[model samples]
Target: MKKSPLYLSILSVFLIAAPFILTARYTQHVLIVVLLYVALGSAWNILGGFAGQLSLGHAAFFGIGAYTAAIIASKTAFSPWWALIAGPAAVLPVALLVGWICFRLRGPYFTLATIAVGEVVRLIALNWTTLTGGAVGVVIRPSLLSGTSKLPYYYVVLVIAVVTVTLCHLMSRRKLGYYLMAIREDEETAESIGIDTTSYKLRALALSAALTAMAGAFYANYFLFVDTTTVLPLALSVEIVLIAIIGGLGTVAGPVLGAVLLKLSSEIFRNEFAQANLLIYGALLVLVILFMPDGLMGGFRRLFGVGARKSQRVSA
Candidate 1:
């Protein structure tokens, strides 16, 4: 706890200086995307990791946020800045509603329901030509970003990522975090102890949805476009979950590590083994899961004997 402030200050300095230090356009773009995933992964971790409610349809909330801002920007001549707030705001009620309905189920049933919700939202975006531009998608005018350089996008996403991670960190240490983790471990036990599992789950989902939505809005602005396929894909949702699970579930820094590893590895695979990239990528993920069921953090702890030391201390 004493070193936290120092570590945070260092991290902030590095993030702020990253765009200038990287210099290369492609590197900056990749960094922006990495930060985006960091935010997305952490947001998903709030519910999926801490609360144990596996949502296979978070892309629905994400797409809603992107679509909300895109539709609003396309209609009005206002600046895209409004989306930083409006996007998440639009998603809040929908998340609550979804939670209210889906929380009634347990385990895989809840997961399946989320998948259905995501597909439903995607289909709506695909067919609703008048509102969302249908399959044609909505393209942002030049007025949206105001520049060709990636620095603005980089900084915006950086801030979002930092805020999202910070919130997740804070939440994990508070009552909500404990309640959600209790739910994740054993819902009936948590309920027996007077923890309102449903209510805490809803809160986790709402927080997760808003942060995911914010990232979605950034996706629209950075990519300068939005479509059902791009914003609301099952693949995207899966990637978000993989980031959390692969990095370290229920750990604050895990998503950041996971995002970096996944994004960079995918980029490498695409460039080096263009034809067999998907195969290699899937195999790599499998290997990681098989060897390190608790993810990279667990592997690191075991390798460094951190777990052994902790056990020894507990025994002592």
Candidate 2:
């Protein structure tokens, strides 16, 4: 299928006018969540997709970003918006440490390291009463737009989502993106070609971590709360991966599409199958993975035959 900017332009205009089109607060809420998930999924894709490093522990960076902002807002006089910078900034060192350790391993070993590290972070958040407020969680001071209108929050998150996609698109068009894909497809070959596999992977991780942290901090302030289980759970990490994978890996539109499908399915399943939501959810994931291994976007591409005739079309 030939890629065109028309679809993106239309989508952007529709989203921008969504407030006017869908006035219901509930609808706005759903869309907001979708946007947030898109950002989170895109962030994960930086490492998981292009870099070929599937990180199942992104929740650690996410939770840390949430707590850092919430804590600063609750305990100090600083604005929660500080988290936009502080969140990603704070995650830098953690990303470095994690990359240093996990990058030492390869394949499933690296994935396992991320899971273990994530679990450790979750546990610390659960037990560390002084900082993270233990299991009680932290209620962040609301952003200035809290009660004013969900519109503001909606736009803010939408911007983050757009920026995330834009950044990933730009990165994929750059040398770094090619290097990451090279590393992902074959690390040995990438290194043999003098791509500096480790260094490039680390760079990808840094960007991925910062983006994840930014999303987490936004989640905290927008919701006015943060909890270890909610923000740091292994399930959350898995969900991020699912979003990227189910939408389409190694593509910019994959995460956004995955977020929309998953979020809609989850909301519907939860409301309609209150008693067996988990069972239904599991079934849905299984079905998606079984039928669409390359993700929904990839499925669409095949169904409509979307691929580069001249080259992989830049427009998704």
Candidate 3:
């Protein structure tokens, strides 16, 4: 299929001038958060969207990355840059082990196992006082670039977001994506068709965990703080899942669009409605699930009839 010229042009323009376009410090800060969620959402989609593996333990991996980076850097004088690589590397083995154990289960049983794994990780972070700094949380001095400046952080996160999206795009166009989709549709059928369902599923989980963990490492360094409540919380995992679902689970751009819209809407609600923001957010989520299950991007595609004909062709 030919790529969309308009989409490519817009992307190029945005990448070239995002810094100039976002002049306000507050705007830049919000953009950073949006980009972070966008990356995280895309990462989650690898497993949930591509492989049909529902993981409720992503925040556990996220926290593992953050804490690993923080502790290694703080204790050994290693660059946080190095920690970013190390943190995700540390998470890969754990994700593989978990995948190996839980891939035998299907549906909700697997999902429940993931949730339990997350809780176990969170409990460890909360109780391991000497290693994780316990409930007090580890605080690092601000970066030499200073964490307060939004511009530098914005560019840094923007680069990461670009890389993340590119990786997702590449993966989605490859054989791995086809295998994942086959598994998502029917694991048994996929296996019958000569796909190594177990190994592919494990690969999906590992890649998802590694990417999410890298985001966590960046969050720790950018925010200069790591706490179990913020990093390892179950709520964080839920948010990741929500973004991916609400954006259009299986599509490449769905999670990115979902993150931007949700984050922006939530921010607006927080600023204007304050105490009532949660109510509004909850209501919005319910509405989206009920009426727009395929999400904003999905709706857009449907409205334009770009993919509808293809879908119809397949169905026919």
Model 3: weakest 10-residue lDDT segment is 307-316
Clashes of each: 0, 2, 0
- Candidate 1 lDDT tens digits, 38-98: 9999999999988899999999989998998788778887766678799999999989999
Q: In model 2, which runs have C-alpha deviations exceeding 4 angstroms? A: 1-4, 308-316
Instruction: List the global CA lDDT of all models.
Output: 0.88, 0.89, 0.85
Would you give me the overall lDDT of model 2? 0.89
Top candidate on lDDT is 2
Across 107-221, the per-residue lDDT of candidate 2 in tens digits comes to 9999999999999999998998988899999987666778857899899899999999889988887788888989999988998999998889999999999999999988998
Q: Give the TM-score of candidate 2.
A: 0.95
Model 1 ranges off by over 4 Å: 5-7, 307-316
lDDT of 1 at 225: 89
lDDT (10s digit) by residue, model 3, range 9-63: 8887886687688788777778889999998999999999888999999999899
